[model samples]
Target: MLPDALFSLTALLYVAATASFARYLAAPADGMDGAKVAEEGRRDVRLGTGLLAGAGVFHAAHILVFSLVLAVCPVEGIHFPLSVVAMLTVLFFVVLRGRFRIDAAGAVVAPFALSALLASRFVGMNAAPSTQVRSALLPFHVAFNLFGIALFSLACAAAGLYLVQERLLKRKQIFGLFKRLPPLDALDRAEHRFLLAGFPLLTLGILSGTAWAQKVEQGGLSDLLRAGFGWATWLTFAAVLLLRAAAGWRGRRAAWGTIAGFASSLVVLAIYLGRGGPGGHS
Candidate 1:
């Protein structure tokens, strides 16, 4: 019951933060020559940041409580790890806000807040083996994959925004949105960094997954299929890297690639969940 209440509160706080972020992003940043747009943007950011900070505290507490309940690291598996990843990203974003005008970037970051909140709801509801899944190699795999996906998710959001901004730029109709978005150089570099960091983690995840599957004594075929799908996701991300490196895929195409890879990985998760996930029909 306490967990449920915490989950519900976290979700409400996330929704509130998302709304505040949207307001912050949607507020005008243009025509500051004589207008109060900067003041308004600052106000919106302050409100949104405050709400986001509150949500972050709740989320951190939830993880701490969950860890205590389980008597293990709260980031036990893919799901819990994802929640941690999202939480850390929020932390990073908050810390960086002072260095950069990232208020408008909230629109790019809020979905992660929502995702983390949703993931938190399942923390204890699932009856799967929540014991410490310790394999020295396995932990490495999970760690890399979690960070990779977290970074990629951020990239996905930024890429989506980049596409929109690029389109508006190409169309030469960017008076409003143009002023609102981050500089094109910033967006481009962001995409590059995500791919640069994410590609290796994804590669390692694929390798570790294969190693884990090969060691399985039963359900060889099904496990192979599952791992195959994971590899497929890895391959897609690899291609995204290649494209970004060699073919110069950016903006809309890069965004689609990231989304596709993430979706494929999600399908792998769905299979896991459907078979025997926490609170899943096992």
Candidate 2:
């Protein structure tokens, strides 16, 4: 009951945040006075940030209570992956939005978080791992992967915003959301830094997952597909970073690569959810 209540409140918070961000992005800047538009944008961003922060707090509580209610470890099954990932993503956005001046990116973050949160509620409720497949490394593998996915979510958001900002700049449409968004260079840097930070964690997750798979003798097609997409995600990010350092790939090229890598990671996640749960095939 407590978990349910917390979940409801969290959902409402996310909805409010999403609305605020949408308003900020969609509000006209041409007809309105420049000062009024700037003020309104700032107000909306602050409200959205605050609402998102509250949502994160409630999300954490919901996870804890939900895990307790089920008497299950949060990291042990697919039940919490989407929820945890969403929560971490929101928390990260709230924390770094100011630092990175990416508050405008909340337009993406809020809806994604809300959708993931709602999806987590309906997916994998009955799935659990058998005793034979359980291992000490399983929790670490899930944790690392979840955290990496959260960071990748942020990178994708920044990359998406960078693309929009770049398009507007190219076309010379600089009035509305363009004025509200962070600079193009900042978005690029944020995307690159997020990828760099998440890469090592993803590597650890892949290594731990491989060892766990070997231990469990998971040789099925689903396992193979998941591994393939997971590696594809890692390789894509690696190439993006490598090219950026070696061949001066930044801006649009790097943004597209990050989006592609994030899409691959989502495919891996979809495979997990499709199997009923992470533990279902373990």
Candidate 3:
């Protein structure tokens, strides 16, 4: 109950932050100043970011206390996958936003965090798999998968914005929201680095997952489907990285690849969370 209360409070903070960021992004371009107009709305962005940071603090505390009370590993349960995903995605964005100059991306991140937290509240909690969690390698697999998915989500957000900004550029319409997004090259580079950072973790997760599946005798339809998506996701991102290296694929092509890869990961996540799925969260 206490964890629920904390989670509710955190969700509210995320909602407020989402509203602030939306307004910040959609604000009128009045009072033209020679200084950077993005700076003009820094007040809203800063307020929103501060609130979201506070929310993240409470979110972490909620997970810690909740896990302790349930005697369950937060990362090992199907119930908390969405919550962890959203939390890591938003907090990671907060850390890297300035570095990447992708403040506008918060428009997507805040609502996503809020939605995930809400979903966690309403959904029934699934206990960790007995046989799966007993393995010594389980923690490593879950940790790497969680962190990898989080990074991939952030990368997809950047890539999505890149596509929008790229479209606006091609249309020669650079007056409104287009001005707010990060430069194309910056987004591309950020996506690339994020993929690079996450790919190794993904590799480790897949390898460990395969071993655990074998140990647990998990080869059902849901298990196989989840595995398929995991491998497909790995391959998709791998190609995205390789093509970028070998064929100079950096713009629209790369964004598509990132989005496709993330979409496949989402399928894997969905399968894990629903019906007769694989062991615990993937």
Against the true structure, candidate 3 reaches a TM-score of 0.93
Q: Number of the top candidate by TM-score?
A: 2
Candidate 3 lDDT, 153-175, residue by residue in tens: 98998899899999999999775
lDDT scores of the candidates, listed in order: 0.66, 0.91, 0.83
* Candidate 3 lowest-lDDT run of ten: 273-282
Error of 3 at 43 (Å): 1.4
Ranking by lDDT: 2, 3, 1
Residues 1-282 of candidate 2: C-alpha lDDT, one tens digit per residue: 799999999999999999999999888887877678788899999999899999999999999999998888988867888999999999999998878878888889999999999999888877875677789998999899989999999999999999999999999988887888878988998999889989999999999999999988887889999999999999999999999999999999999999999999999988888786555753
Best by lDDT: 2
Candidate 2 residue pairs in backbone clash: none
| TM-score head-to-head 2 vs 3, winner | 2
Quote the positional error of residue 101 for candidate 3 in Å: 1.7
**What is the Cα-based lDDT of residue 125 in candidate 3?**
67
Per-residue lDDT, model 1, residue 102, is 44
Stretches of candidate 3 above 4 Å error? 30-36, 124-128, 131-133, 275-282
